[model samples]
Target: MAKAFKVPHTLTLLFGMMIIAMLATWIVPQGFFQTFINDANREVVIPGTFSLVEERQYLTPWELLTAVPRAFAAAQDIIFFVFIVGGVLAIARRTGTVDALIGRLLKKHSDKPQKLIFMVIFFFSLASGAIGTAGEYIPFVLILVGLCKAMRLDAMTAVGMTVAGYGVGYGASAFNPFTVLIAQGIAEVPLYSGWWLRAVIILPFILIAFHHVWTYAKKVIADPNQSLVADLPCPLEGKEATVYPELNGRHRMILGTFLATIVIAIYGISQHGWYLYELGACFVGWGLVITVLGRLKFDEAAESFIEGVKDLTTTAVLIGVARGIALILEDGQILHSIVNGLSMPLSHVPAAISAVGMLVIQTILNLFVPSGSGQAFVTMPLMAPLSDLVGVPRQVAVLAYQFGDGFSNMIVPTNAVLMGIIGIAGVPYDRWFRFCMPLLGKLMLFATIVLVLAVVFGYGADLEVASVFINNAGVVS
Candidate 1:
């Protein structure tokens, strides 16, 4: 009899990627990009600074073994932030705020399933576009999963809505500090130069996402057997909420603090340049406030927080390991080579095709460099010069970068936020892949069109009015 091949767990798969990266260090050419601090005071690579490293430093077995710990250290901010969100959310659940909110949401939109999906997709996308939120949605996964179960939908529907919104919002990010703003700063364009186009584009992409998710959700609702996750055990299998708790003054107060914390976090991120540390502190403060108002005994609140963190142990591991993949590639001294090699072709292509090629390169690189800001830093400098050579505006290059980074984020195994969110929802990586691939394809198609149109219409009017294709020999034609 033939044996069935079970897909590896996310952790195993990430470790395998790390091993590949380590091996690439030995096989791939060693190279590095010279860096300088730009006007933004950010370390950015100087154009034409890429060169072969004089000495090849191959990472040894000990380094591979230690990459995980190094990655944990590098990713601690995000890891701790995720834990804080989870713990505080768990406290809210214990206080019945989660259930009460779910009950109210379901009461308002359960029978109106399309409305619920649209709201989730729209609001999630809006947050991502506006504030660059990604892993922040992890706290919503289980809540959405339980709510979907009560509505006779699968967990895939829940995650699909969350991830689609995140992905599309990022692809069409207007004011996203993490991706768009950083890319713009690195690209040396005026801040938010093409905001109107990005703002208008997100709506259509959101519709595309909403339609894709709603199609799958409708099929699953009509026939549970058709669910992509039919065989996987439902997270809320036995505890389906038939009766949702009513929101009393206490529950309402707790939920109010939740919203207030989010508002304050947004203000801080936009006005004061807040990040994981501040966001985590805000959530912790919210947890204490809820504990007081929800009237959870000190022990109960503590237990709830502990249990929440305990549940996310796998999630934490996934996020940390995912970071290691990039670390291995970086330590190998091949990351710049990968970027250079991938981009070499664009110089030979036409302007419109070059724009698309930039998108494609960014998409592939996202698998290795998953962080939005990190990808921006690594690619934008190289791409900015390359865009001038290939008849692509520097601004369009930034747009393509955002498209590649944001859209692929939904499916890239190396993306810690995607893995963390699915891990919490109890969805297997393969299952999430199966469910998200179509949506990703649809979004990518729309993104391709947008990139092409941007190239045709001169989307970034403020920068690079003259785009001339140049050859490697520095001859412009």
Candidate 2:
């Protein structure tokens, strides 16, 4: 059999992709879909209103270099959030609270690692599926790695329980504002309108993910050297994996503080619509309190915090450069062109086929536009109308968009969050993909079947024509 294609170093591959996005601007006609502000106050694209405009925005070589810096500027909120998360993790680690807890748990369940695996994966899945908390898990990636080692598991298992678990939740989310909510709003469906079906679909996918990760983890435990990154310098390299300090009362208090903050964060997200900036502040306050509680002298705390930042410096740069890929596409004004090209084929397909086709297009588009909200804003406008022509419900199109925007992030090099977290844990892209591809393939298959059923059954098919901004002069009748 021919060898499968391997993704390159994350940076090298992303920079190359950035150049491809730039070149696409020259080849694809510059165009955009007109947008309108909805009652919910979101700037969603006006359906069926795409037009060819004079192409004014183009990137020169120097302009391309400038895009990286501009991306950093535009993404400062996320950039700082990443730094703050790193510092918080460093403080927590210094307190030994995280390690102590992991140690105790391992000691208690050392003979029943499968129970521990399922619980951790499920916790992450619920957090991500319910709240769209993808990036917030980065700081915990290293901590999970430590725990996995203590249980005789590999880096893949650690990520599978955390990052991939989040991916399943995120991909199958019924109410994630960044993906599901925005796409539904654009499709003119009630926010979280068909959550019952989505909730049902999410369970099977999570179970599939858990089984795959658990099986691999058990194998690694049996033969420790069988681990994919057995030779890599992991975050817990040189530490004894089998032994952990007994948890003291102070440690319990610190952990209680951390857990309470997580609950508060979730509450804020669910009720108050808090996002990255506010969540970053939560971590900031957590770090301050933990540092004082742990009684680390100022100099010692500062050193650990800086050391954490230094470790994540590469991860941070990878994220900023990944942002450049999207920026170049936006600057080149080819993102809409690509969307237009992808939408053209669906016009003639059967409703069921068109629904699945939307999934395929959105999945491919995710490689170029990795941001969930960004992809929703770009694709949902066109997809919703295409669904109307083919007799599929607009909500089904939103389903396609949400599923497409999500699962691909698990393996896409352009996904800065996944790549950054993997890099921090010393797992190569190739190794991670090897573990994720088969599982992701199964999830994609499941998603396609669900989408086809939605189309056939008219799931959430009600149309509120007056609420939708139909382009009378454009494609809509």
Candidate 3:
């Protein structure tokens, strides 16, 4: 057989774009760009004081070189964490802990495929929300794919299901500290205010995802020769295979410990609130538990951890390179220019149209700037006020940002994890998009409709605060 091939077009294109964007950042006069944006916002005062004066402290060539190391360091932190989990998972697999538990769970849920799917989605979604980074979900994705394959379902079916479920869960996240709370924080909404409303949407979205994947899987199974169902690269061997295993006593102990750690972590987040510090503590505590309960020698566990981290090195580097693109756009002030360019045309439409316009704008911006919080930081201040001027509520504007940011993960090249997962699955970017775009459309449309309805019903940012009154207020008052 021909040696498995690795193509780097996505990575290459990302780097090339970053270089071009960064160079333009240095060459474009910052003053010229700011003047353009200031002139664009009609409702707000175009403060003469707010001039586009370019700060001349462009990153030196040396500084650009320095970003490489800094990027690597960030990547290292992510890789180290993954390595620890992966190593323990590998040990668990070798010991047959994971396999046994999965078998038991499957048997218990055999009569309810839909229930099993929902449980998996819910469990992983909760984990992603608590962890705050989708990187943590990679392991679960691997496990899902393997289980699906073992059950005679196509692997990509698992891919579609996992990614779509995650996107929906992440989109309507209740406990996501990173995307939800962070975006809310930037938009100045109180924490947990939107939880009940968000909760209402979760089940529907998860069902949509489940149906989407089930349909796709049935088609592939029925027509094995379909182009989309063509053979993918064989699954990664060695440590990657550790997430699933045959059931045994050691496996039961490790699985129990893992489940307990998850329960405790959720409790910790509820008590302490979700923050990186709390998250880090949870990871550390879980790692220690897995290390001790699995009974692996310390050296063996450490090696597994290192291997897991190594798996993500490429992704980390891609993330850093991707971040540089945003930094460059920030320096050039071109990001503002792009927003200004979009706002006027969008503002002319009716309020609902304008709301949709904001989502489209945010979607465009997301390709260039993938960070949910960072995008909100740069765009929301302007978006919030612009939304009000265009007769959209501030909260609705936030929802627009959320949909725009969340839905495009299915397509964005700059999302390293998306790319990394696709690479692991051996699906081309174009192929994945072809499969996912329809589902993305459904999600985006559903989310848009929800936001529009919320706006129509006067469901503003204060819904949660209102809930408190309903719970606590007296008729006399």
Candidate 4:
């Protein structure tokens, strides 16, 4: 008998969330956190400073329609970046450079392809863990798809190697200034203080995730029909998988140019605080350089680049739709209420339970507040004091926030980066969720265990021997 199957379209799911957010405005009391820029120019929530705010306008049928376009306006930067990067990658592929490189590499590793898979996983993890390169790698997903197809694997495997790997490493980040730094500051702990411990906790979890992906990859290789998208026409379908081509001089030049530009982009990010636009410019520049060197006709180059953009146009629109959920929550002034509701109960729990509770709360809150820095501004000040009263280490609280904010992006529809990456790969959100659910469970369980250990061992700054009471008057020594 054929099994029952149902999974909502990604846009349908996102629209459902927007409807819920609209209803929430009417049901949940509208509240706001008064925020001010700190000395570091970061906006932080003031503990005990939340107050009921008047709703500017209740969500109406028309507002729901406008919210999507407004969200698209808000996300123009990221959208343009996606278009440019997609175009560049398409141009490169059209040049036959990527195919040539893969042909050579796969021919050499045909017997031990798992070795190559593991290497890709580790490299992606390191980039995300060490430098906070989560969303920046979306363009690389297509390249990974190319690699996976060449190995007779599926697109989900490419996602596991790139998106999932990035999420795991990013969630278990050691020194990501965007998440760890802001969280440490608001939690009143030294920045990067818990790097050694974070590394110890995260590395093992990432290894487990890698093994999980590799196992599925091997299974799909053994039986192609077992792949999740076996019925759909995959981008890599019908491609020449066994043709081995020698890497000619033109291929080497293109590859070298792209690799060197990536290094430069990394340096720009680390040293100059670059973001999407700058990174997108790098890809555009590389594309132009390769086109000129390869001496492609203008029409040919433009056609290839436009085809790439066409392939990813759906993804770009989905990103805007996903952003609409967060947009509505913010405009409704109910985001703070959601955070307050989730965190208020931790005060009564035991110290260990409270720490774990923060992780659970943050995980849920990430659905509404997907931005790491934005969530930090909204939740950290309150969480820090709550940790103090319950004798949970400030660092443990930060870890909970880190794990919640980073890892949940792997599955959250509100997260445009996740949606965008998977959309580009042509994997539906439900299918991707089914594949990553088991691994996400493992990561969360491991995170909870780590939080328990942190509390048991007094992770990070020592809890003050003197009770730091938090009441109506605020923190008391």
lDDT per residue as tens, model 3, 44-159:
22212234563654656665556556555644544444444454455555455556665665557545545556666666555554445455455565566556554545557666
- Find the 10 residues in a row with the least total lDDT in model 3: 40-49
> Could you give candidate 1's per-residue lDDT for residues 397-428 as a string of tens digits?
99999999999999998887888888878888
In candidate 3, list every pair of residues with a backbone clash: 31-52, 79-309, 83-305, 83-309, 97-251, 99-245, 100-247
Better of 1 and 4 by lDDT: 1
The better candidate by lDDT, 2 or 4, is: 4
Error of 1 at 266 (Å): 1.0
| Candidate 2: 10-residue stretch with minimal lDDT | 464-473
The lDDT values for all models are: 0.87, 0.80, 0.63, 0.83
Q: Which lDDT tens digits does candidate 4 get at residues 338-432?
A: 88888889989899999989998988999988888888888999999998888888889899999998888788888878887888888988889
TM-score of each candidate structure, all chains considered together: 0.94, 0.91, 0.76, 0.94
Number of the candidate with higher TM-score, 1 or 2 = 1
What value does the lDDT take at residue 348 in candidate 2? 86
How well does model 1 score by local distance difference test? Answer: 0.87
Native-referenced Cα lDDT, model 3: 0.63
Off by over 4 Å in 4: 1-5, 54-57, 237-244, 463-477
Decoy 1 TM-score against native:
0.94
